[model samples]
Target: MGLDFDWTDEERAYRARIRDFLRRELPPEWGDIARHGPGSKEQTDFSRTFCPKLAEAGLLVPHWPAEWGGADRPTWEHFILGEEMWASGEPRGAQYMNVNWIGPTLMRYGSDEQKQRYIPPMAKGQAIWCQGFSEPNAGSDLAALRTRAVRDGDDYVINGTKIWTSYAGLAETCFLLARTGGADTGKAGIAIFLVPMDTPGVEVRAIPSLIGHGDIHECFFTDVRVPASSRLGAEGEAWSIIRYSLANERVGIPRYELSARVLEEMVEDLKQQGRFDDPAIQIRAGEAAAACEAARLLTYRVVDQKARGGAPGPEANVARFAVVTADNSVTDFGLDFLPDFFSGLNRPGYLAHHERAIVAGIAAGAAEIQLNLIAHRFLDLPKVAS
Candidate 1:
């Protein structure tokens, strides 16, 4: 028989509960939007109403410990929840920091109070957190960031600008990394702080993305002050914590349900155009179908390993690489159906696979970075001219 990673009867029941909640609590319009969901910047903003409701339903942070307001379910349960939500084409309502990134990273490395103060509100959706990691000068080379923070009595004053801050304009706090030691401290001087969004001298400006969403912003901090007690873990250890969290962030294995919805729509469009029998288009569509299924399996494999307490290692990158390709391929196939009769020339359909493909390469990690990681870390390739 084929490999069976079927959920237990109890797990199945739990999923049904989540499904019922989604049906009752989520906006009715969300069902269709959940599939073929917004990839645009404007659309990426999780519906504000749904986020707090998700928190109320105990669905936002299932992977967290009970002390942190999570349901404390096993990892497989978390996967099931993700599957059900994605399968519904539910807009991913919770920001990653509250659900995955900073909270867990904090639980792993934060002082007890830091965890106590930050995690619960995040899980409850009473607070929204933005990541302050990337900068114009320090994206792929993140350690080169020039943001500075200095000690003054018990308070740390921060001054820096962070770009590509997803949803910062709407966030209530930021998991900010700043040069606590000095500009020359390299990665060693970095410290992670949970800074309130309303802190004086902090500024947020929406930045335009290809998808034209307010979801991405540029967050600026000028002399922002916070007590040192707000720091996550100890001074100078932020490098490891951030790295560990990001590894899991990238490991947020993609599900094909969303792409499958895209495929279904494309097929309908093709049928309407009376070109459903086109051999080349049929072949392309078939390839996308196979790729999407394969990507889903790769993602589930990672979940299986983690459910049993295994680490998400290098193999997890396979999911990121493959699924992105699958999404792009599916998009390419669908966009080809754009009718030429409107202006006597064909134009791209906004919802077509092609539109998604162009942006697929940018999400999570760029393809080049993923390949480099696989090469050096997985393949054990020797570094050049170090």
Candidate 2:
């Protein structure tokens, strides 16, 4: 389910090193962790403990500056690191904001002092960061976020709620978006802040997932004040920064790992039940397998383009659209099977997951949105009058 892209002998050596490390370090309980998921305390504690292990092995944050406990390697190394982590189902201890989202944003916009203060702890997983973007009213349409931050001298007083906040219940700090300008702001006047969760007037309430996973949550801030230095970039620049950071994250490791894992499961189930010999099942299963591979290829293309210092426009849109379509469709063929096929799953998780998996096209960003971006931004299509 992973790639075998051609790489230099050095890249090959590095991948071997990672394999060696995982063979040594991954706990036997790794599968349990993946199934039940880690708690706020457990996940944070594990990351805090394991991150240093990754750093000691020189495999942490390969995309970041070397001074901050990172390998500072090129883009290809990232693929090896990610694939190794995924295939083993190891705890994603090092993927803290350091490798994926926050580190990149800091590299793009942080002051030197901000970088020094944040990057080292993140690289070592000694610190945890969460994102404050989604709200009850503004998830898919993220620009409608209602969190507010008003300036009072050198301090900005913030008040609002962020729902479905990833890891917020566990994180030490959050990179948050809040409105700084009045009613007419729309997307233009929102400001982002790097606010510590321990700050007064902040509350984290765990909102358990559809399957009872406690990681995602709702974070509330009321009269939480921080120095102006907490802001991520220039005033009102967040609209653009948020777009860039989020566009990168819309589909990354989760999409890759889930697609690969699901495809493998489907093939194994078919083989075990002796359905592989059925021409109908074979044709359907083969298409599912190929589609997973296609999703990975399209996703990696965006990662490759970014390595060469390109933005996400046409290529990213195409990848997202194709992958989302392939991902959701490939899994729902289970629906084509006899009802007896589902007898193996009596649990609430699988019972609900069957339906939810079909909606992947509309989950992160809808297929409709992906298509619109492709047309308006990539193909320069004119909007029809509403």
Candidate 3:
């Protein structure tokens, strides 16, 4: 018999260990904290407290290089940990980016000084960094960002605004992108900056969002001055660095894992209420479950490639699109059968899942972009001329 969907004993043990830790470490009010969403101030603050404890327990950053406070474990272990966290409402909050991609990005591109200054804090779960991508004009086409940074004597003067920034209201630093070249530079002129959020002239304004308060913000950097050492890579290198980070981020959240778990929860709730016996409802539930499974399988293929040290390709796009579909499928099932849960009835999990599902296609990158990539990269289809 071929090796089916079974995990190795060690892998199972690792997952069990994480599950045990969650049971022991999560506060009694964890559901309340998580209901605020991962980007909310309540959850981000809790992450600051909770993540350090995880670090001390050797569960944080275990996949990172040992030099950066990790045990140099296999990539599968890292992914398994992420799956468990996402299934449990991602108690790590904004720090998930730290372990998932930011720290790894810095490890590869950052100078010694930069790594020393940033990696240790992330490994210790003491840092919160917000992404400074997506300007008012550059949401999906990130290359269209208008933020600018001009070189000065031992410093760079940055001026631009980033919208839809998660954790900006409480982030200690921003992994920022700004055009250092002329306005026409497009992607080539862009550069990455590790800007401290507390710098003079930097401002963050909360944007009330369905996701939760404090979860999204508009960050305005007006003549934000920072030493040249803050740059993550060489001039014009932001495009490649950002691409690398996005590849890691594409499958980072394991949204399908959460969606699948939520689907089960919804079905169980329906059964308890004796509403699951209707054939119509059962068929829809099966369809939703199938969608979730499809998503999980697609994401696993990407993870498998990553485990084998392969660079991310168009498959990542397919996986991301699948995960978004799964999120929508599960959320739709809940909304159709349990409308009361979404209407201020305090079904926090359902509410959170609904909000997240609505944004899954838009966040990271748009769902349309994924379809475009699938057409051009996966199907070898010709692009239409504008």
Candidate 4:
């Protein structure tokens, strides 16, 4: 089949509608609030109100099945929604995870009880969830995770610590992973749990960082007890489920859309300061724009595959790396030419973008991992023997 680059008229209209909604709904102070990033308390609090309104307007989960409160809209429409929200500093906040992957993952693997109890709140935009996946020792290598969940009667006792958990300080629930099989089981030993944040022995401590307030955190689960019913899927099934979820997550952010917007803003700033005439700066800005577009097209390929009901493959890895490159390129251009803006609150957007760019390589998954996947899976390169 031939690759079609054009968006349908309906898709264009959907994109326009999202932009219109954002323009009409966002408060004047939104830029200031957004400067702290999506996981900040301000943005998280704002989303509680904002996202419900989005749901009321039928915008929160358009790609979801009608049974789940969405319109059963095409995937491209959902991708457009993501691009618009991300470009607008992600007013949906942490709930974007629900719209992007978590809710869908639950629908696929969650028990009927889990779906009825949890998904309704999410569909109504009244839920906040944190991903308890990474540990200090297992950031990208999830198979190496040490968090243990021992089965006890009808319950499981969980004891482990998660690091760099975003939105944990405010999330009402956690999508946690734990080791159920013996230490030797590797990926086959893992299990997923949907634990309520209010459960006993759950502790969350905020970690100060440049990304945003309340963004990254350390969560401790000591003797935390949850019913077996809370487990997302069958024991030893987490690796497969996680692969599906990460494919959705890896390309969901539309970070290049945000990067492109920030690049335009940087160019405007340079123009105002009479620096656009500099040939070297102009060339760098052009390179950043090209990077953003390259990332955008690569991401669209993955989205198109999803639209066709095909599982994303290593192309998602390539797209993810392209996005990181775009993010860093735009931020690097801003810092190199507009250093003054990043020093203080004057250019909150630039400051916010810079902070996110700093962690772009690390968040979602490490960029190095993406490169390895691209080398082995995408390029079909021979692996180096250890």
Candidate 5:
């Protein structure tokens, strides 16, 4: 049977409803706050009020099971929700992590007590969380992280620092990974932890960057102690759990939707300036739009796989690579045609898209890593010997 590219009537109605909710609820100054980026205090603070409203409207966690505050909605609806939210500059802020992958990961791997303590807040859109994966030396090579979690009686003492941690400054909890095995144990020895950010010895310092205020951070875990109950799963099980989490995360953000919106705005700006008649500009815009559509289609394939209950594989890597390319393509087109917008605060949406596009390849996972995965897994290429 051939694939159907059209959305069903019900799906179209669902998307329209979400759009109506956003049109009615978002403040006029939302564009200003959104320009500061999703991890900025301005946006995160807004999410505290905005997301609860989304939950109240049955729009926040619709894909989650009914027992977990959702209506047991289809996976496609979750993706539709994501596309609309992202297109509107993601007013959910850092809480999108809670809605996308973190809450579901916890539901899958967390214990009864852990789920009871965390998942409810997430479902209600009240929780903010940061991923504690990247470090100064580890970046894309997550298996090489050196943070240690040493057990002491019923508690584990965590030490070492994480860099480039988004929302670290404002998050109440951290989905942390630390080594529990010997020095040379690598990926096999790592374990996942749910540590409260307020726990003593946990220090978060903002990292100065062009991304946004309070966006990237350096999180120092100095002898931070948490009970063994905080561990999500058995030691050495982190890799599998992380894989599942990353699969959800890789395709979760509909960044291409935002990119396409930005591209359209750029076209409109050019048209207003009478530059739309330029064939060169039109060609470049068409290429950028094509990239955005390509990324969207690739991402849809991954979402389709998830909807069919198929485990995510190298297709996720391929889709992620396309997304990064699409982000860069639109941002580059904007910079080439509309340099003035990048200089001032007048075009906050363009500025926001530019900033996010700069790091799209590096965040989530590096573009190089995705290419490596696609090479080996998707392309079935042999690895080069060191």
Candidate 6:
């Protein structure tokens, strides 16, 4: 737990190079692209173009194995890239999932054929993936999902619906989960599937919402049949794979980096308007910045553990909850002091941040779930029997 704040020269150099690349390559309209939101069709489509340039520059998926088009960089470098992207309003868009956990999950659990088919596109930065983990009835309690995948000789017929699916409207593939086990199987019987979004019986309907345009959707799979080869691992192996994926995915995005950057912008805006001289505003700004720093350190601990080859643990949950707090704090500060920004008066970034912050606690497996994990795992508290 000793804090080492100094970055190695190599790490510093790498980070500088990445920053330079972003400054040079990010389009002039990047702010507007980002304002459209990460899951919006504009950003997703933009990613299809932007990400390949990143891959060509050897910046995309640098942590992946060399065989999968990466330079085999360290886990810290991978997280550094994520922090930069998130802070930059995620110009990489939905492809971040491909780099973060989806590709890694496939690398760990996919069959050789599956890896060959899927990992290359992801590595090339030409893939957009949507996660089908939540449904209206089974979001937080994912094991309670009713998505069924029945074996029919060489294929499995999938029938179910997934709600709150981001980037579903334009994604090329879905990192899907469905039940392959019986009624009594529970988590053990669940399995992962790589389903093509263009497959017959797959329907995506955009849900009208405040978060962003085409950001969330209702995805219905009606008797969709895919080859059994689409399954990621063996049947009954999904829970473990999912646990692994979630562990990687949870800390993958450095949302606190974005929150911290937004706070800085808000503070600058207030200062320019002569409002930062107020004691109340300054105190709240310090509190929000401190929250962001606390979240950053907690998240760095998780990344440090990963860099040392340590497995994910309750620390990630703690970091995630801290990030949610940071997100809300920054959002609230804007709403409290810079109220006119919400009305599209002058700052569009504030509105974008507000829209995204609203879902920070709910998305990526709710903040409450993380608190429960902290209680049971970190605090070693016993769970009450239902």
- Residue 112 shift from truth in candidate 5, angstroms: 0.4
Could you tell which candidate, 2 or 5, scores higher by TM-score?
5
Q: Write the per-residue lDDT of candidate 5 for residues 199-311, one digit (tens) a residue.
A: 99999999999888999999999999999999999999999999999999999988999999999999999999999999999999999999999999999999988898898
Question: Which ten-residue region of model 4 has the weakest summed lDDT?
Answer: 343-352
Pairs that clash in candidate 2: none
The clash count of every prediction, one per candidate, is 7, 0, 0, 0, 0, 0
Write down the lDDT of every candidate, Cα atoms only. Answer: 0.71, 0.71, 0.91, 0.93, 0.94, 0.91
Runs with alpha carbons beyond 4 Å of true place in candidate 3: 1-4
The deviation in Å at residue 108 for candidate 5 is 0.6
Compose the digit string of candidate 1's lDDT tens values, residues 164-264.
77667767778888887867879998888888899999999987654334556788899998998988877899888877776676655354666776677
Question: What tens digits encode model 4's per-residue C-alpha lDDT throughout 1-386?
Answer: 65589988888888899989999999999998898778988999999999999999999998889999999998888999999999999999999999888999999999999999989889899999999999999989999999999999999999999999999999999999999999899999999999999999999999999889999999999999999999999999999999999999999999899999989988998899898999999999999999999999999899888888899999999999999999999998988899999975678888889888877899788999999889999999998889
Against the true structure, candidate 6 has what lDDT? 0.91
Ten contiguous residues with the weakest lDDT in model 1? 341-350
Cα lDDT tens digits for candidate 2, 9-111: 9988988999888778767765445544433455456667777888777777776667666666887677677767755543564254457767878878888
Candidate 5 segments whose C-alpha is farther than 4 A from its true place: none
On the 0 to 100 scale, the lDDT of residue 357 in model 4 is: 86
The clash tally of candidate 5 reads: 0
